[model samples]
Target: MGMLKLEARHLLAAAGAAVMISAPASAATLEVHIGSFKNGGTIPSKYAFCVPAAEGHTTGGANINPRISWSKGPRGTKSYAIIVYDNKAPAEHREMMNKEGVTMTADIKRHNFYHWVLVDIPPNVTSIKEGADSNARVVHGKPATPSAAGVKGLNDYTKVMAANDATKGQYYGYDGPCPPWNDDVVHAYHFAVYALSASSLDLPKDFDGPAAEDAMKGKILAQGETVGLYTQNPTKGAKASK
Candidate 1:
């Protein structure tokens, strides 16, 4: 009887090992790449919403969206999403922002400023060409619309320029970084890609970053990101890319 019990236990253990060996592996993290700059490297002025100006603190840049590509999502991934935002935006303090004497320190209060929010990208679409979303600055901002690549959603620039007559409008799609010129801290722009289980979030018209995030919820399968640094401050060693 003791020998029979020991053999039963051995059989159970063997079965457990077989089950473990046959089990599928977890999904791998997607590999994201930025064509214009290295990950965690400085971003060029050509891809910025603002750049160093000869006379003023800053001026409108090329505003081109850098080329981006990503690895295919794992099995069960139906679509993908791209979100680009600045993680080091200065806090709301009008008096000190852009002031020549004021130095926005690294420890200053910061917030996320969304520059691009595109969703519902097809699984087969693995890359976006340079300037495909935005080639130059639009005076009143581009129209919020959907295209072959994905749905272009409202960026933070809409709120940032709401009070300005010349630039005020519903800014959409890829509007690149424009860190405060007086800021002493270098800003990090995160270009993230999300692999989703669903084909579409079905976001509402004129949807923003928060709205997209709400829609993504539990549908995200895998995600990856690459960071690019930028600062309009001349002392930070960034030259205007003309």
Candidate 2:
């Protein structure tokens, strides 16, 4: 009877150890939404960088920032950061693109380009209204003043338009999609919202997407993302038929 009792105690201890080993760390949850378009859906032309227009003149889209919102962040989340990037841009010879007008092909390896970077979003703020940062063409350097919600960061458009005589300026805020018109592949724009533990990033005025991301490292409590598709080229069959 004594031996049986000892064995039962050992078995219970082993079971408890197993349970402890299998337990998972607490996870944070976040839900992201964009009212202008659905996840994995086609983005409207009005949100594109350049859209087909009359008189053979390519015109900029409505150039409005899409409405974005998120649910409550994790328990420790005190602020949020928004990043919009395109992972399908050609990686080769990006520096010479402006001077050479280099066209990116579908076969090349793609790289990321940051289109929008807004940071220090207050915990109480849950949404950004549409057209809040609208401009027909590119706008150079928005004031770095932090609003009640947050401040805007420099986007990749600043780099792209820096060499252009007419568009050259320190482009900031949201610049919509403007993928190559001849590429065979359609590009996807990823919009991510990160719940951060820090109340403010305290980033410098020159901070870009990468800068903001680096500052938020190890401070992120949760993250959620949505993708929107865009293309400057028409479908192959549709173009051929036309």
Candidate 3:
């Protein structure tokens, strides 16, 4: 599920950080994880998206999304939200709609890519489907479908992405990878979950990354993360270059 991967790279930390926020009332400490694997766990082969030797290829792996779970969040946590992104992308994080936010490599534009952004998730939610957005799909172009379980946030890719060569459209959800062809390094996808006092954050519907992060400046009570790596290529000699 690499829907808005390009745009999410910029907004996840910058934009989403402020979206759903509330001063935490509980003292619970939330622990992050990947499926059942605890944080800092090994990166699985099936989840590796890039490698040192897989230089010019696109991988057949699912989106970097992982089954996530958390606990010990502060009291009054009415909802939880999730965001997945490539924090290792070049410092080229910015609005994909603007030239300033972009970087050129091999004559192609490579900017921040978005993966998944989910919001309005109820506090009781303890686990996300293993491959929820792995297919890199979405509804009405928003970041995610809110899991029958939550509200999906619009990823940054929607602002400047064009389904066709003619016009740019608003990207509403997850967009998978298309990293630079010559990226000397594999990118790191950071999957973070935030525990909030409310089920949803109060922000504008069409908000971008920086704007959303601003909205949640002080509302998070507890948070944790699950990290995964991804890229267009995989090394042949390694353990699938996970």
Candidate 4:
């Protein structure tokens, strides 16, 4: 009877130890940061495609890409991808856009407008300094090319600039916010980073945000983002919301 009781105590202890060993640890969160702009704060005009102009509604801006950084991913993270896009692009009443006598109200529906799409960033790389990718705006847009840092994907400016002959080109990499100057609402830009399981998604050189997102669908191990607000409208100042 004494031997059986000792055996039962040992079994219970072993079972408790097994449970503790098998339990998972708290998951680490991926954190993103932008050096030039605060999350949920105004994005400076220096990083915009257009800024408030004295003569009229707007004018060309410095258009510099802001500095971005992120925390290392959890174990098995092979690479990273960065995507920047405006989340409040007017989706309707396009005819009223930038018209002298009309206004694009805040009630108008909005859509996502890709400003930058870079992928296949090395696992060791965790930060991109300001102006490292783009120091100034290119007239016909920069070439969609691959470099040691990562691959630059085509931004939505490709379609937006299609109507103009001089600016009509494959607008690649970063082209900062240029929301309609006549708009009544402020726009939000999301700077997101994704830790990918695959080193390369083998994406084509002409890929866009949607394509990059599709490629990263199953391979994304973790993700994080920060939002910055911007507006070309003079009425809605830098800190204006809605």
Candidate 5:
């Protein structure tokens, strides 16, 4: 479990830096780690602009690409996919869904929330540049892969803001967090690295997190990740919690 754990859910909401392969990955597994200019090339800073946790700080011009670095890709690993998610979301995603308007209730905290899901990455790529996907929004059903190579997957954010045109669109790529304006603890964003046998996970069209994971099941050579923490409440941003 990367960015977000399966059971992790943030009631108030919102959500690493690292690398240390204690065990050898599957025959040169494609490893991904978070890094930041503030953390000396580690994971992205919890105080970045896109995150609600870093609300008042003004992001100091921090970019979205979290300085991801990787190594030891699996043999014949055509390409790689990275996913960042928040484990602290409402257990049942639709529990808060309503007819006229589905709203995220303040009481409905702690649920599975997927912040980012990227697919079809070029196997040759080791990592992404900082701020590459940050808070940018693209088109619907379009290929949202990086200019280098690959395609984008539908992140959970798509359905979240779909009602409003300005924010509506298929989140085919990365979309950072801006969780509740108020909350308790900082949310954890698990950055998972998967080494796949194919260039992409070929599942039914418009697959989500669980779907993608199932498609890649058993096919994954190895996976590893580093986590970063962010909280809507600024006090929690301290390094100790990370």
Candidate 6:
């Protein structure tokens, strides 16, 4: 009887091992990269909007979208979405910041400024070559062209320039960062990619970042992100006043 009991235990252990071996591998975390800036590194001025300068009008950068690539998405990922957001933008204090002598600081609670939102990227697509999605000058908008691989959504620039007669329009696609010039701290921009289960988001043409995020709620299988920093103030070493 004792021998029989020991054999039964051995069989159960073997069955457990077999089950473990046959189980499918878990999904993997995606890897993302930006060729223009190192992770957590400073973003060049050419990628930002023009700022007033002593010498002449100077742009924060070239206003071109950086080259971005991703790999190792989950096995069943059918499509992808990209959102470039500035977490340090003074969204809540926009009106206050425009007042004379008012300054934005690191201590301020910032808000998301969606600079880019591109979705419905087919699984076969992996990278966006630099400048392919943006122009050297800031255009009012750039709706997804018929030949484009993905759909472009309205960026926060539309709201930022809503009152400006010269720039106000339905800004779309990638519009690089243009933080307040007098801000006391450098702003971090997150470029994140989400792998979705569906082949297409099928969102409306007017969809923005928030709308896209809502649509992708439960469908995201994996995600990856890289951050880049930028500042318009030359006094980078100065600390914000308490």
Per-candidate TM-scores read: 0.86, 0.79, 0.62, 0.85, 0.65, 0.80
Which pairs clash in model 4?
A: none
Task: Write candidate 4's Cα lDDT for 1-242 as tens digits.
Answer: 12223233333333223111111234345799999866666777789887777666777888899999999998998999998987678788877888898889868887778998999999999998898787788898988655447889999999889999988999889999998888876676788888888999899778998899888877777777777777777666532222
Least well predicted 10-residue stretch by lDDT in candidate 4:
15-24
Steric clashes per prediction: 0, 0, 44, 0, 38, 7
Candidates 3 and 4, the one with greater lDDT = 4
RMSD of each: 15.0, 15.0, 8.1, 16.0, 8.1, 15.4
Best-to-worst order by TM-score is 1, 4, 6, 2, 5, 3
RMSD (CA, angstroms), candidate 6:
15.4
Among the numbered candidates, top TM-score falls to 1
lDDT (0 to 1) per candidate: 0.78, 0.68, 0.51, 0.78, 0.53, 0.70
Q: What is the lDDT of residue 194 in candidate 6?
A: 81
Q: Write the number of the candidate with greater lDDT, choosing between 5 and 6.
A: 6
Look at candidate 3 and tell me the lDDT of residue 66.
Answer: 54
Which structure is stronger by lDDT: 1 or 6? 1
**Ten-residue region with minimum lDDT total, candidate 3:** 233-242
Best by lDDT: 1
* lDDT for predicted candidate 4 compared with the true structure: 0.78
Deviation in Å, model 6, residue 68 alpha carbon: 0.1
List, residue by residue over 1-242, the lDDT tens digit for candidate 3. 23224433543444334223343465345677777443323344344333223432334343344566777467777887777665545454323311332333422333344556667678777777665644433333434334556655666556535554443555544455444433433445566777776666766666555554555557677876655544432221123333
**Candidate 6 wrongly placed segments (more than 4 Å):** 1-27, 55-61, 96-100, 237-242
Candidate 3 vs. true structure, TM-score: 0.62
Residue 98, candidate 3: Cα error in Å is 20
